[model samples]
Each structure stands twice: as structure tokens, then as C-alpha cells.
Target: PASTQRHVKSINKRASGQAFEVILKPLSPVSDAAHSLPSPPKRDISLDDIQKKLEAAEERRRSQEAQVLRALAEKREHERDVLMKAMEENSNFSKMAEEKLQLKMDQIKENRDAHLAAMIERLPNFHGPSTSLHPTPSFSPALTLSRADTRPWRPRGGGPHRHITPPHTIMLTTAISIISGYKHG
Candidate 1:
């Protein structure tokens, strides 16, 4: 029986335009190889990968938006805090000013009260024993004169007596009468 020989051929080409060839011999089939061979798997794709990427991007976007919103909130909160602080300070200042004014008013009232108290203390007591000051004049009905003596009294009806001498002439006549009486005495 002739020997069965397997020949391999190969070819190569060089940079100088040479050519090269290679030949491979097929191997003999093994029993049960089909069972040992692995089949080509279908290309696999998992929804988890795309979903994870989407989730990561969404998370990043959410984080960025949250940061922006947080910054805005913080700014508003800071402004509110500043406004509150200013209002509190203003209220405190006003309260202090009011207290100072009230204190001044209280001081003025106290001074006025003290002055009034001193004045009251200085006033003489009316209910105490009377001291000798001036002698009171005794009153007599005979000392009272009517218009007849001071001036010539005219009667109610426009009738007999109507003496209307000027005050100066009456005073002169009374002085002359007093001088003549003193000379005669």
C-alpha cells in the first residue's frame, strides 16, 4: 500500500517583488469533538448597561441641577437672614431709643415732683395758730357814706337839685374850707 503523505505549501513575496505561499494540511476528525465544541453565541446586549449609563447621566444632571437649586436657595436664605438681622437690629435700636426717651421723661417727671414737693413744704400751714401781722380795722356802719356826701346827690326825678361840680373844683373848695377852719381855730 502506498504511503499517504500530506504536503504543506507556503509562498512569500519580498519587497523586491518576490512572492511567497504557505499551505496547511487539514487535521483528521476526532470522535465526540462535536460534543466538546462550543457554539458561537449570539451577540449579547444587556439593558442594564444602557440603563446604567442613562442613570449615571441622569444622576449627574440631577446633581448639577440640585447644586444650582441649592445655591439659589442658599442665596435666598442668606438674603432673608440678612434682612431679618437688619430688622432685628433696627427694632433693637428703636427700643433702645424709646427706653432712653422714657428714662429722660421719667427723670423730668421726678424733677418736677421734687420741685413741687419742695414748694409744698415751703408753703405756710393755714390751720396753725395765727401770728401778729397787721391789725384789722374795725368796721362801723356810720363810717359808710352815700353819694349825697361824696357828691350832691340828685333826686331820682329830674327836679330841684342838680349840682354837678368837677372833681378838681370840689377838692379845691374842700381844701379852702379846711384851711379857713384851721385858721379860725
Candidate 2:
């Protein structure tokens, strides 16, 4: 029985690197059991041999394309994960800051309310009419108004419609001052 074989020819370059025509012709197959020859035996390069080589090159090209696409998809997924993690961290920070601000505001309100209550309770005991008329054993600036602070000034309305209540003795000084300035500076 005989066997058919396919072969490819390698191009040889001249030592001078000159271009030459390659004329292709049909070649006969050599028997494997023959005596050693000085030169390599040539074999036929048929349609099947060409098709097999082209198919091998195409296969390599397709495999490389698939590998590149897979790598790109993995990179995109990693970027999305990193972005989501950063957004989550920012959201947590904002929530913590808002809670801290709310706590500070509540503390301020409570302190203000407590201070106001204490001031209201102490007002009457400290502001009697006698406190204004007589000097204490020690000079206390807080309980007494200076002569400048006691000076009279025009009330809010400045005209006929000023807030005058009644003939009460407590308001006699205020009524006289308002009437004195009704028609002049």
C-alpha cells in the first residue's frame, strides 16, 4: 500500500538579499526507506495542505480575539465595583455628619432654655425700687444703672400716638416726658 503526503516549501534568501522569482512545480514523494540523499526530498503541496494551514491560522486568530474580549469585560466589572464602594463610603460619612450636627443643636437649645429660666426667677428679688434709690455697702455695677443709662430719650412712636396707658403713679414720669415733647424737639 502507498501513502499520500502534503508539504510546504520554505523561501530561501540570497546572500546579497536580491529579489528572485520562485517557479512552483509538482514534486514526487520520496520513500522513507530509501538511502540517505544529499538534499531534502520535495513533496506535493495540494489544496488540502493549503486549506489546513489557513484553518490553523484562523483558529489562532479567533482564540486571541475571545481572550481579549474576556479581559476587557473583567476590567469594566472591577471599575464598577470600585465606584460603588466609594459612593457607599460617602453616603455613610454624610449620615454621620448630619447626626452630629443634630446632637449639637439639641445641646445648644437645652442650655439656652435652662439659662433663661434661671434669669427669670432671679429678676424680682434683684430689681426692687429701693435697690435703685440706695447704694449697697459694696459697689455692684450689675444691679445699678449708671446716670447715662437713666437719661430720657424719645420713646418708640415719637409722636401723638405713643404708648401711654393710664393715670397710674408708676407711669407719671413717663407721661410727663411724652407730653412735654409732643410738639417740639
On TM-score, the candidate that comes out on top is 2
**How do all models score by TM-score?**
0.37, 0.46
Displacement of the residue 159 alpha carbon in candidate 2, Å:
38
Q: Once superposed on the true structure, which residue ranges of model 1 sit more than 4 Å away at CA?
A: 1-53, 126-185
lDDT winner among the candidates? Answer: 1
Q: What overall lDDT goes with each candidate model?
A: 0.60, 0.58
- In the range 148-182, model 2's lDDT, one tens digit per residue, is 54444434655765444333222333332332343
- Model 1 TM-score? 0.37
User: How do the residues 1-185 of candidate 1 rate in per-residue lDDT, one tens digit apiece?
Assistant: 22235566756667899786665544545645765779799877799988999999999999999999999999999999999999999999999999999999999979865754553344323122123332112111113223445565455768777776545334434433433343354
Clashes of 2: 0
**Where does candidate 2 stray beyond 4 Å?**
1-37, 125-185
